[model samples]
Target: MNLKRTFGAILTILGIVGVIWGAYAFLAGGDSVGGVSMNQFSSVVPFIVGLIFFFTGISLIKGTKDTA
Candidate 1:
């Protein structure tokens, strides 16, 4: 398989999970593994990561083929 495709797949999955977990933490109010309390801004980290992965995945999946 293509390297880009592989990385893209991983990022996509991470993004989805991050967004979901972040939302859950935000709503349910929980502490992270390091004991960090979830809050309005703190809980957004996952969502941010998710967005990064989602966008990166899209970019990778739609990237132009190299002819070199």
Candidate 2:
């Protein structure tokens, strides 16, 4: 596999992990590391990260190969 494909895979994994972690933080109500609620704006970080990862993965996967 090419470097782009490898990066795409890694990004995909990171996206999935981020989504899961975000969902957990959203569902499992409790105090965060800083004694704050996980459902706060900071909690959205995971979702955003996940989205970034997902989009990057898609872009990489869509890239073309010019070898002939």
Candidate 3:
């Protein structure tokens, strides 16, 4: 088992969940992004972080050579 790959998979999964949650929360809040209040802006954080996590995990997994 590749530890890095495993960790990457975990990150990817978390990223997916976070993105879904953030997008849903943000959209469901019924406020346009341009009109977002400070409190509403909080919902966007997960989305940005999720994108970072998703890309980081993907790169980590792809760049890591299989030891086996």
Best by TM-score: 3
Q: Could you give candidate 3's per-residue lDDT for residues 1-68 as a string of tens digits?
A: 99999999989988998788778768767554445443456888989999889988998899899987
1-68: candidate 1 lDDT, tens digit per residue: 58887788788888888888788778766655336568666788888989899889878877936445
| Best-to-worst lDDT order | 3, 1, 2
Q: Which 10-residue span in candidate 2 carries the lowest summed lDDT?
A: 28-37
C-alpha lDDT of residue 44 in model 2: 76
Model 1 residue pairs with clashes:
none
lDDT of each: 0.78, 0.76, 0.81
Determine the C-alpha RMSD for candidate 1 after optimal superposition of all C-alphas.
3.2
Worst 10 residues of 1 by lDDT: 28-37
Q: What is the C-alpha RMSD of each candidate to the true structure, in Å?
A: 3.2, 3.3, 5.2
Query: lDDT by residue for model 2 over 1-68, one digit each (tens)?
Result: 58787889889889988877776776666547335567645677887899899889878877846353
Q: Best lDDT goes to which candidate?
A: 3
Clashes of each: 0, 0, 0
Q: After superposition, how far is residue 44 of candidate 2 from its true place, in Å?
A: 0.8
